[model samples]
Target: MSQDQSDKGTSLSLEQILAQAEQDQSVETDYQSGFVAVIGRPNVGKSTIMNEMLGQKLSITSHKPQTTRHRIHGIHTTAEHQIVYVDTPGMHLGGKKSINDYMNRTANSAFADVDVILFVVEAGRWTKEDNAVAKKLQNTEQPILLIVNKVDKFANKEELFPFIEEIAKEVEFTALVPISAYKKINLPAVEQEILKFLPKQNAIFPEDYVTDRSTRFLAAEIIREKLMRTLGDEVPYGATVEIEQFMFDEDEGRWIIHALILVERPGQKQIVIGKGGQVIKKIGTQARKDLNNLLDARVHLELWVKVKENWSDDARALASLGYNDNYSS
Candidate 1:
């Protein structure tokens, strides 16, 4: 086995290691790699920008505010560089009992160890909330890039200049990039700015690898995304998906996945199930389709709804839900 594979603790089946070595040898001699954290308020298109940067849906995104709860890293490798982009939860003003407070802390924590911070903003308006967030970015030691997303809505460049100036006055940004994350305008410029900030380090992840998250975690996230999209308001925010069992039968070429949709209360459970299991059935069908596409095989997905009262507040439940004090800022 190659040294790299061994370091990853993978006892690759001889054939795999040789194939990987051949691919590794073909990589460019001089390569740069680093991490960039994307931070902004809810619904500013941070996830959308990360997805566009990687040229794939590495992060789950939706129209609802604060869709991303955790810090998800998407690695983009080129012949010259490997950029591990971290998509963080949105930063906003928080209340003592509010989950939004928790999310804001998560977003700010990404700035601690990253090389660059991409501060995304909505193109149309700059609210007082936007100014407050910009002020926080000014205090960060790392290089900050002001990215004005949703610029496609603007009719001309002149219309965007005022908002751009307002942000620039607040923070000493490394670069101010106006791009539409949805429409993918001026994305090449964003990529160029990312390269400039990246450290001169060897590639941390193998060229073929895209993310650090497991297939199961991503599957659960996709299900959560569907829940966030289809189920309106509080249902999506208050819910979490946990995979109880995931067994892949190599000989049979099938995957058996049993997951529990955990909610805070019985009333929320009823909403998820809907009238006669209609909503959950729809959730299952959509989730299965996504699973099949991601796994490249048939998936026998079994979903069960369980009410765990105050799962967010319970320490053990928070740990099980993938939230720990270590993740807190």
Candidate 2:
């Protein structure tokens, strides 16, 4: 037996493994493909669940609410099913700005024709935001899988049963599964539940594809994530990231990315730039490392903090920042 086979929990022979691999390469008769929307209020781990399902870090994560402000599509392909997970911004009822209105519309628009919905909430706790999310998602015919996230943080495991029961009373969830999206607990079960609703069809995308976003978009998001993590409360609610330039040199096997960190005020810019440029340098370093890993090429990143006042409230400003969602739902 080969070392790979020995490491695997299965004791099948090499011929059997190869045969299975060949058989599982791509079968169209029973193949499945559909979209699954991960929706919930902010900080409830909706992005975390999408990342775990796709086994890639495409969406940004931060302790601050509203970290995800757009709809991101992350794809997961396997032998039997291809699940296109749509990670939407947290649906909230708190703001009146155009940006907030855009975010709310973007999230609600994802429910048009999805095969399944993952309504994620923190384990053993319920808040008004949760009620609001449930209310918004009401009257949908599609099946919803209630994903109770952060189960590892719960003090007692027994609370999960009653909690699931309590949440079930609010909406007719097809099923409820407690999982820690951060720790990847019970992920296979979650995957199985979603696959039950997928239609029998061929893959919608190339087998090796992972996402619809380009490298420039991902790089800008990486920088914003670092800024959100490092600055925390200092990062303004209207903060937005834009890629000024992204260039690649085939001969040099390198990439050059120039990005602008847009803030609403001078003080926020000062905080982002930091004293003696330490904070900006740290953000560039972390973002470069991730960019290099993502592209498998050396990245030279340049960051600049610029002031863009009240862009969140202006309609034209939101469009210029690429907040439009023209998905063919």
Candidate 3:
């Protein structure tokens, strides 16, 4: 075995290591790989689940709904399989802005080409939005794995039965797995279920690859996540981040990033900047810490807020801001 496989084998129990060897010998190193789309309403923990499964954070997350604006591919590779998880924006209703349309369109399109769909829903809570997602998936041929997330919220396990029954009536899922993305509960079962449906094939991406998005895109997302967590209720919906300059300064041995935070109204810009620039300064500090982890090097980040005046609602402006449907690695 290769050194990489040997390293992975060291973590397994003796029985598990033997099982792995037996399986490898039986299949003669057969590999399974495919795409899995994570779909749900806002704040249902779709991104969190994907991040946990990949053993790292690839998608930006916040308590705010619609935080994930773009489709991201979080690729997880092991010796046996490669699962490219497609993380999508939450599907919601009653938003007419161009950005809203873009988010919903990005989510809808993700279901088309995926090998499996992880339909995530909060345990004991089903809304019109969840119903809408279920309705949309009524005729899809791909295997739908109903992930009843956040079950840890319930103190008693029996309480979940009723909610599970309710969900069973709504979605015709191939399998139902209860989990808590936050608590890391039953996550391994989720992976096992997904493997059952994946087709046997060669790896789709290099084993060292973790995501399909550019590092610059992830930096912008990290900045936006800080903005979403820092700003108030209304401002985050109208706010977006654009990376103006991203480069490695060899002399300084640090990555330098200049980001512009755009808002639809001037008041929102003021809210982001705060009374004495304290809020934006805090945002910059938080984002810089995450950027240091993401780049594995010192980062010099500069942030500025500007009034873009309905950039979220203008198609050309949205496209310019990287909201286009053709966005790719």
Candidate 4:
């Protein structure tokens, strides 16, 4: 057996791996490829915008603020160009936990070494968090594309002009485009703006690869998303998911996954499990549906809840749960 099977954890033979590598290296000379960092404050539709651009959901999103805890890359490739969209955790000011620090550091680091920066903000809603993000972008050298998302909420397009002008004063952007990522309104314009700054180079990742993260990492996120969506405000923020076992069962012809949900306190664990285990069951059902879609195969998912006190605050525990700076697949 090879030392590395596959980054996505699919059991591919050496020949298949070599064939994919050959395809990845055969990009045309005129191909335009570069990184575009999607950044903003929490729940400002940054992840939604990237998903709209890529026509797929690579980042786990929820209505809750600070739902995205890590930086994820969603890759889009075409005959003409390849755009790697870096979806980061929403930059915020508060929260002194270790995970919060990790997320903020990850978002800050993404600003460097990127071809363009997509500074996303809600259409009619602007806050101090948005101002903080703008201040950080002022020092960046890359072309900042100010993306005003959720314009569909406004009935009158003319109302957006004043709002756009207000943001213009705060962010020194190369271009400004208003879009509704949720409604899929004018997402192409956002892509067009990104292409204007994308460099003429070869593809960074394999065309077949949609993301830099492993299937294991994605599985954990999917499970985490369900927890975020289903649980209450307090418990979800205190919770994190860890994949203990992720492997394919050849005899059964399905993927088997075991996940451990860590919480800060014993009461939180009980809350996650719910009365008669109903809550956990519902979360599992919802997560399994998404997991099947993500893996494109049948999945047998097992979920368990445990109390790991203050894991989010503990630096070592945070790293063990995949909150580290080095997010190597």
Each model's Cα RMSD: 5.8, 8.6, 7.6, 4.2
Weakest lDDT window of 10 consecutive positions for candidate 3: 1-10
**Residues 198-257, model 1: lDDT tens digits:** 867677666776666666677788888888887989887679898888777677767888
Question: Where does candidate 4 stray beyond 4 Å?
Answer: 1-6, 9-28
Write model 3 residue lDDT over 1-329, tens digit each, in one string. Answer: 12232122124343453354345544434799888999999999999999999999889999999999999889899999989999999999999999999999999999876799999999989999999999999889999999989999899989888888887787789998999999999999999999999988676665666776677788899999999999889999999999999888889888889999999898998899998999999999999999888888889999999999989899999998889865542
What value of lDDT does candidate 3 attain over all alpha carbons?
A: 0.87
Model 4, position 235, has a per-residue lDDT of 93
Best by TM-score: 4
Candidate 4's displacement at residue 79, Å, is 0.7
How many backbone clashes are present in model 1? 0
Q: What's the TM for model 1? A: 0.87
Ranking of all candidate structures by their TM-score, best first: 4, 3, 2, 1
Residue by residue across 1-329, what tens digits does model 4's lDDT show? 11132264234432364456456656657778888999999999888888878888889889999989898888899999989889999999888999889999999988887899999999888999999999998778999998888888899989888888888888789998888888888888988888888877777666776777788888899899999999889998999999999888879878899999999999999999999999999999999998888777789999999999999999999888889865644
Highest lDDT scorer: 3
Model 3 misplacement above 4 A: 1-29
lDDT by residue (1-329, candidate 2, tens digit) is 12122112123432353355445546656888878999998889988888888887889998898899888878898898789898999988779899899988998988986889999889988888788888877898889999988999877898678877788777788887888988889988998899888888676655665766655677788888988888868565868898888777667767878899999888888999999999999999988888877777688889999999888898998788787863211
lDDT scores for all predictions? 0.78, 0.81, 0.87, 0.86
Give candidate 1 regions above 4 Å deviation: 1-29, 98-101, 325-329
Which scores higher on TM-score, 3 or 4? 4
